[model samples]
Target chain A: MQAPVLGVKALFFDVFGTLVDWRTSVARESEKILGALGFDLDWLAFADAWRGEYQPGMEEVRSGRLPFSKLDVLHRANLVRMAPRFGLENLSDEVLDDLTLVWHRLDAWTEVPGALTRLKTQFRIAPVSNGNISLMVDLARRNGLPWDAILGAEIAGDYKPKRQVYLAACAAFDLEPRQCMMVAAHSSDLAAAAACGLRTGHIARPNENGPGKGEASPSVPVDVAGSDLADLAGKLGV
Target chain B: MQAPVLGVKALFFDVFGTLVDWRTSVARESEKILGALGFDLDWLAFADAWRGEYQPGMEEVRSGRLPFSKLDVLHRANLVRMAPRFGLENLSDEVLDDLTLVWHRLDAWTEVPGALTRLKTQFRIAPVSNGNISLMVDLARRNGLPWDAILGAEIAGDYKPKRQVYLAACAAFDLEPRQCMMVAAHSSDLAAAAACGLRTGHIARPNENGPGKGEASPSVPVDVAGSDLADLAGKLGV
Candidate 1:
């Protein structure tokens, strides 16, 4: 539990479900975009169904069954596959493309901006997410998320929970893994990053999926833990 | 004359000469650091000597004489090779490493900060330099460059003046080359980018190499040209 978080030079973030609340944002985006197209359906379930394809899609790349494809590409393919199940058949390519980009337009957790601004004062900050470069860019631009670099899956040419993704991000900053901290809401992500020798900080995004549906606390040990990014920032002495 | 500069979505900058005055900055840094240890030489010439190796070093990778190496690695090797001439032979690895990082400590031109801030309101801005990610991050943090992403040679796995570097940057943003403008002070850089279908904007760095030694104007045609970054920002209607 006593990892050296104080001397960390970089903060590598897990974007989805950590910095951003994808469930409500995606549900809202789906409702607005698809609701206008005369599609009356359970948008939250639609959001859940779309997100449900995330792991299996990544597992394909992670297992080496398929070559490394960006998260955006995987999101699109997953969207197309699950579209029929929601009775949303024969959606135009443009519409499908628009929906796929829902991931890019998600809103950040409320306290993330202030925490990140404070954290940037002391450390290099970047997204170490499975999201592609462009997706991260759109989200940052939209939400004023001040990232020092867009790195991770696209830069590593591999997905996260894979050692390369975490290591490549640290290497990109020319810092040792122990000199960097991986901050995420998910223990699995933190565990993977920890296994790669990175210090772990947890931000409890209890409502990441929906009210009371996300990780409210870390199940595993971490160097630091906080109820939100602002608390995490304070905990880190930033 | 018309390359659709108005519709450009992203601005990819050439950092060394275009955004930062590397020669003066490096010379000052070298004198301050190395002179303290009692080694003296014509530091301006020293800066030039270090930069002088840039093209040949990159050409090694470009010509496939060597595999792709980050600009920092090439710079360190070049520094080590040239050190003996300046009576800097047998320096410890730490000192050599510190000297090589001079590239990461360069200052932005006087008007660059304001111009980039103004331009950021309308476009996504990032360095498309051959400089590695950490170098870009360091330069940005030092000078408040405000880049949305640190991308270029390191992410592209190759050096600029290469078509892949420019194309890969565009691909990283999911943007077409035509939708992005390559902004640099060097005509060769602009021309190479133009060949890859990117529009070009030139900001004259009249003293980038030395007084009257840098590009006062684009040698080739460009979509836009200006006295400096502020002028370029104005010309681009930002």
Candidate 2:
């Protein structure tokens, strides 16, 4: 293995696609809840539509059209907006709530648990995603991810790609941005993080969007790259 | 066990005196560092004097006299103020910085780890402390305190007994105040938490101060009380 990057004291992860397999998990959960209701829509497309609204939902807050709100609240609003299009317009609050909470029960990519446990020995590891604190906590509890702290949008009062979100996570550790590494599968997320002076690590998630969706890897160079979390751990010399 | 307080889902702890024996730990760290520098003074009294300034320091921000700042920054200021009185007028920047970080190395009370471990099995546990996130993370890592998240002054932008701190912690869990319990050794802290509609758990740290300092338990009634964390865990049926 190559020598680990020097002076990196913490690892901040991008959760939705980089760590948790939200696509499959959400699809499974939507199938269970919607199937029981006798709604036979394409669950994966429903999941994609729900997720596609994430950026625009955050953009409302980011653009100051709406005040800062938790991701869960934004997600619920988006879910409500999409329900009618998906033919589940009359779903009860109970079903809607369960479908929304599927984000909390997301399955971590196969190597997440052990890789994080290994990396944690050498560095403080935390999520720096757009997920709100409660959602992050529930996801951590459900997936057994060992996080040193739950930090993200709710903690920053803003979503990622916002300079404050990245800087605030670094400040939370009392460390300089260069002393931490932002790990994500998306080039755009890493580029935003790198612009804020954080070191970058990339985990290639070629199947993050499901079999044919092909979510692309970083176009920009990263300090480290791995096929999976275990590969990242190995390369980090953890 | 009496049903674990019905619907209590999270336990928020007071860190300084309740979970950690800060007086002892701070005194020891001070003695070790200062003694090596050829200084001799009332170390325990120094610890108390340093800690006694906590609430007043926070009041500056809570009252809006100053903008929000991390506890570490406030702690350094307090250390600077108290330095000359102990004949440490010429302390170097590095030494002062190290001394300020002693709060990060406090030892947990003997029963804390096992008790928290047990309680974590049944409910979320976190520190609702005045210490900044970095300090809390350091203390957790040093002492094996299993926190679901670090929530406190940093997140709330205000110090405790302020409704914002308690409310923010509850909000982080997406919980009502009544569904969360404030666990502390100080009645005043618990009382403030109760005023915000949270349940309260009392842990008796009769020796939190120096041997004869005689720190007292809660003067008001608490929902649960125990001689130590183990006793508290047993009482909570964890």
Best by TM-score: 1
Error of 2 at B37 (Å): 1.7
Model 2 has how many clashing residue pairs?
0
Error of 1 at A32 (Å): 1.2
Residue runs of model 1 more than 4 Å from their true location after superposition: A1-3, B1-3
| Best-matching candidate per DockQ | 1
TM-score on alpha carbons, each prediction:
0.98, 0.97
Superposed model 2: Cα runs more than 4 Å off:
A1-4, B1-4, B212-216
Candidate 2 global lDDT: 0.89
Tens-digit lDDT track of model 1 for A163-217: 9999999999999999999999999999999999999999998877778888999
Model 1: docking quality category? high
Docking quality (DockQ) for each candidate: 0.88, 0.82
Candidate 2 residue-wise lDDT, B1-238, digit = tens: 5754789999999999899989978999998888998888888899998988888888899899999999999999989987788788899999999999999999998889888989988999889999999999999889888788999999999888899999999999999999999999999999999999999999888777776453456788789888888998888887
Instruction: Provide the lDDT at A201 for model 1.
Output: 94
